[model samples]
Target: MDIFLIILAFVTLLIALVGSIVPALPGVPLAYLSLWLGRWSGYTPFSDTFMWIMAGVTLAVFLADYFLPPLIVKKLGGSKAATWGSILGMILGMIFTPIGMLLGMLLGAFLGEIMYAKRSGYMALKAAMGTFLGFLLGTGLKLLLCFYVLYELVSTWWATGFGGF
Candidate 1:
């Protein structure tokens, strides 16, 4: 039974890692669930306080992922239309994944700037670049948090020896 629970926890963690990139999955929450399951399974390496702290961190990162791109677009002199386009593009881009998402955001911002904001080609390109940078920064932060959760899960599993090797 302990081994089964351990395997389940690991599976959840793996899903969380994938969720970090997939956008549709609630990555941090899933990671937290895995940790909670481990705790329920009698793994004692992570204290309740530690879990609470990680939960808070996860929530913050999740929320930040949504706002960062739009905030960055505005700061870089992008109009409201450009910001909305980036967001819509991001959502639609999820269908094609990675490359599609990247192109979608850049294209969205460029078109928004040209069609709605009436910006020159050079300015539109600059705004698009800013949107791209924001996207990268947000993704990097999420990956870091996901990796940290993965590390914690593995380390606790190793320390507890709950799987019986």
Candidate 2:
């Protein structure tokens, strides 16, 4: 039974960690939950400090990941329409293909710009680029957070004697 609990905790952590980057999955909270389970298991490998830091990273990344894209698009001179359109495009992208979604963001922004400035392909392109950059940065940040949390988990476990290292 104890062994089963440990296994369950580890599996949950794995799923949460994976979810953190795959847009289709809820990442931060899942990662957080995994850590919580580890601590609750009373056999966590990490010191309290490590777990807290990992949680903090998860929270930060979660906030940034959800907000950066729109902010980036807006900063690039995208109107509200462009920003919203890019957001929709990104959501759609998850259902389609990553590349397709990225392209959709650019096209969506372009279309948004066109609604206001038809024939200004150059300006629309700039807006699309902003959306893309934002999306890229957000993803990178999320991935980094995910890795940080995973590392903490492993380190905590290792320090606790899981690997005999």
Candidate 3:
């Protein structure tokens, strides 16, 4: 049981780390899962309170992950269409390279806006730029969150032994 729990915790942390940059995985949630698994295995120096604290941080990161991109784009004069297009482009972008994904999102949003209102191609470009900026912001925040989770996991584990967190 201890070994199983230990393996689970490690794997969860690993995936969560990847989740930060990927945007497709549940990074924060996976961090929380690691904490939960640690508890179930056996509580340690970290305690439930500490777990909750980590959870709070994760929640903040989650908020940043979801909102900053769209918010940034909107601030840059992007409309709802551009925002939605950015998201769609991102999803499709994952199939291609990261650079491709970024460009695809920007172009997709811009083109989408232009298609909707042919006279606003310039404005559409602005909106697309906003969307790309948002994506970068979100990615940065997510990476930060992922690293924090890793630090917490490593420290907690160190303090508690292999099964300790």
Q: What is candidate 1's lDDT per residue for 65-113, written digit by digit as tens?
A: 8888778888888887787677677778878978888888888888889
Ranking by lDDT: 1, 3, 2
Measured by lDDT, the strongest candidate is 1
State each model's CA lDDT, in order: 0.80, 0.71, 0.75
Is 1 or 2 the stronger prediction by lDDT?
Answer: 1
True-structure RMSD for candidate 3:
2.6
Q: Which candidate is the best by TM-score?
A: 1
Worst 10 residues of 2 by lDDT: 1-10
Model 3 spans with C-alpha error above 4 angstroms = 117-119, 163-165
Q: In model 2, what is the error at residue 13, expressed in angstroms?
A: 3.9
TM-score of each: 0.87, 0.79, 0.83
Off by over 4 Å in 1: none
* Local accuracy of candidate 3 as per-residue lDDT tens digits, 1-165: 865776787799789877766778887788778767766766334666777787788788788878887787778777788877777787788788887778778878987787764528788988898887777777777677667656766676667765532
The model with the greater lDDT, 2 or 3, is 3
In angstroms, the error of model 2 at 153 is 1.3
* Clash statistics: count for each candidate: 0, 2, 0
